[model samples]
Target: MNSRRATIADVAREAGVSPSTASVVFSGKTPVSDATRARVLDAAAALGYTGPDPLAASLRRGRSGIVGVLQRGPLGIAFTDPVQRTTMDGLADAVASVDASLLLLRPVPGGPAGDSGTAPGPATGAATLATVPLDAAVLIGTIPEAAADVAALRARGVPVVVIEGDAGEGVPRIGLDNHDAERCLAEHVRRLGHTDVAIVTLRSELNVTHDRLGGARDVFPDAPAFATLASSIDEGLRVGRQVFAAGRPTAVLAQSDLLAAGVIRAAEEAGLSVPGDVSVAGFDGVPVDGLAPYELTTMVQPAVEKGRAAGAAVVAMLLGEQPASVTFTSVFRAGNTTGPVPESRGVSPR
Candidate 1:
């Protein structure tokens, strides 16, 4: 007999069982008797037949069992941020429950930094959204490219969920009360008699950053503001030095804990004391690796919860359920980094 590719029917015939039984033996969607399973396996081995092709199986089900996580920058650099790491942990936990795997997708070159909402032109890898098979996608942050990415995914009939960024209509968002949280932090400092302040912020292109900045400015309108490209400690250090270059403010409000830690380092290098000479406050209540002997006064946000909500939304969309957008609040945490404004500055408390 001429050699030919073996099919499930061939195996079923050799095993003296129906094709459906043979299929169940491989798919595991239905239980088969031990004797029948053994027979099917023996028949498959004798016929040189492997299990059913994944692509064909997926085609039959109309689902790739893959979830795409659209990130703003290189995965390595993006994962360095503690908030991102924590958020991803929550997302992974939720995605795993649906028996789906995550595919980290990066935008093409010339895109904004990892945390901004601006979208890039195209992806750098062989798999673009237009070509990759994805059951759904989650936008990690607001990027200018978000609207375009959403359009592409929607065109492919893939549902999209956004975390901390606006993707426009019909897209569910997992958001934080950034403005109120920052305002609360601002109020804390204002009550401490801090009038002269400097603000260090993440990329202003992101709505989260914009809202946080706006909240602080609402309380201290004359405060000088510096925007950093990425939410790394190094960027924080650079901006911290600049904030103190001309003149020192009584307090500095950094948009992230890492940035606040960097500002503390800058203050020490400049021979200024933290909280004693210049108070400092930050957002995101995450631990700063090298910030020792000083705890940051910050707004503690539920980073993991934000990610979990996004993941849950993805699962819901995949199930044909419309999940409502969720908004989370942040809690204020007082630490050693902030204190009452120095009384000897010759400036009176507000």
Candidate 2:
């Protein structure tokens, strides 16, 4: 055996088959006979030929076979959000259909600081969409810096798909009916007779937050709104404490389930029972790990479907097909967390 790496040709020669036949066994694009595939596998094992070189194959096809998923914040934080995880799962399935992998790209400072014009290595600096080899990019959330990220990717001729955010004209968006869905939820709360309501938001900069806030306000125009830095339960707890510290409302409308769970915790700590002292409603129907006892009242958005839509759009754009933008609606779910406003509260029932 030679010290050099084995190629498909080596396997073909050893298996007594044409190179194309040997390649077909690996590609799976064209079917090969079971007997011939077995021979090729045996030959590959004997020659220590693992499989095809993805880089070389991608080069031949003029594609990197990589799609960048731009996270609104740190990768660790993104994974903590159930909605993000569910959406990514759907995105993964969609991208896998097209045989592409996802590369997480985080926002960083301006391009590499030198004359080279090449993106700095990941170790030296955060990877920007400009520096990464992405055939297309999916903007996960509406961060304040999203405009610049979209511009950079578009400048490089990469297709962009936005999930729950606006990336300007020409960028196809997979959006949720945040305003309408949230308004529906708010109306439910209002009918339940919750006039004094407080809103807990994910982040101030997110478009989803803005839409949800707008919806809640549409019902309770003067509702006190508190913004959290992240979508984590801890952030929710932090904001929940503040909102509940002084003259807490009869109900709290949290932007995400995690936030609602945190608010529930805070309410308990403040010696208030959920739906007894303060009714809580949340958006995003994701399950919280520790929130077992209380089934959260929330608007169940199709998070995974949202991701699939974005992934499909990416594939379509890559293939030069013009895919239309997608808008998804949320289903209202009734849970024990929300109920008719406590009669003891001074506010009169509508």
List, in order, the clash count of every candidate structure.
Answer: 8, 0
lDDT of 1 by residue, 64-130 (tens): 8788888776686547889989998899899887777888886655444332222444364445565
Question: Number of clashes in model 2?
Answer: 0
Worst 10-residue stretch by lDDT in candidate 2? 109-118
For model 1, the local distance difference test gives 0.86
Q: Which residue pairs come into collision in candidate 2?
A: none
Overall lDDT per candidate, in order of appearance: 0.86, 0.86
Instruction: Score residue 159 of candidate 1 by CA lDDT.
Output: 94
Q: Which portions of model 1 miss their true places by more than 4 Å?
A: 1-52, 110-125, 346-350
Q: What's the true lDDT of residue 33 in model 1?
A: 97
Model 2 residue runs over 4 Å out of place are: 1-3, 31-35, 110-126
